[model samples]
Target: MKERVRAVLVTADDTMLVIRRTKPCIPEYWVLPGGGVEPGDESREAALHREIHEEIAGKAHIIRLLHTMESEDERQLFYLARIATWSFEDRTGPEFSAEGRGEYMLEEIPLTVEALDGINLKPDEIAHVLRGTMEAGALGDGAAA
Candidate 1:
């Protein structure tokens, strides 16, 4: 089985950081920043931090484990986190140089339900969870702090 970690990264101004992926012959979609958990990673949170740095050249303070999804061969852990800054231009992820991996554009969108609805965020279950949480105000103003 494979394990992955991702961050629902919130910025100071209440926006969420996502990566817009564009592939040949496929519609563009957005995804949270993250990747597979490597054996060298000390923990899941550490893997998230490492992945954020690799994918966006950013550092994040993870607040909590927001959600988890599992399939027969893979499990993905999503963390709620706060990020103060990132430099997409400085990203060093190997995927960027890989062939046929598609385009990865860093974008920040409003952390509102309407904003979530407008994008084809991958892993529909996580999108639905975000909508429900945002509606209940469970994330709150300080969620990004």
Candidate 2:
């Protein structure tokens, strides 16, 4: 199975970082900032931190391992991260893709169940994650407000 990593990067203002993927294969989709692990990576968490810095140009503290998703063809690891600072102009990492997917537009949106529900975010892994986070009592009480 293929393996990858991602981050749910929440900022101090209660917004989460998302990227508009420019890849032709995806066409106008949004996702959290991250990528597949590299052979040079020391650890998964270390790769996550490095990826966050590359994707959004920010520093982040990993809150926890939110979920691990397994499928017939792939496995994905998602982590909860509190972001510190960033800049879209300085953002990197889209270049790492094998297809050389380019020019991702970074965005910040409120971290709410509604925000999550409003979009058709994909990979099924994310939807599974929402259910897990909710079941584990992982979400904040005031998030929907």
Best by lDDT: 1
In the range 1-145, model 1's lDDT, one tens digit per residue, is: 8999999999988889999999999999999999999999999899999999999999998898989999999999999999999999999999999999989999999989999999999899999888899998876554746
Residue 18 deviation, candidate 2, in Å?
1.0
**Cα RMSD of predicted structure 2:** 3.8
**Candidate 2 per-residue C-alpha lDDT over 1-145 given as tens digits, one digit per residue, 9 for 90 to 100:** 6668898877778777887666656656677777778889998888888888887678888877777888899778988878778876676665745465555677776666667666656665686576466556565432322
Off by over 4 Å in 1: 141-144
- Report lDDT (Cα) of residue 15, candidate 1: 89
CA lDDT of each candidate? Answer: 0.92, 0.73
Which pairs clash inside model 1?
Answer: none
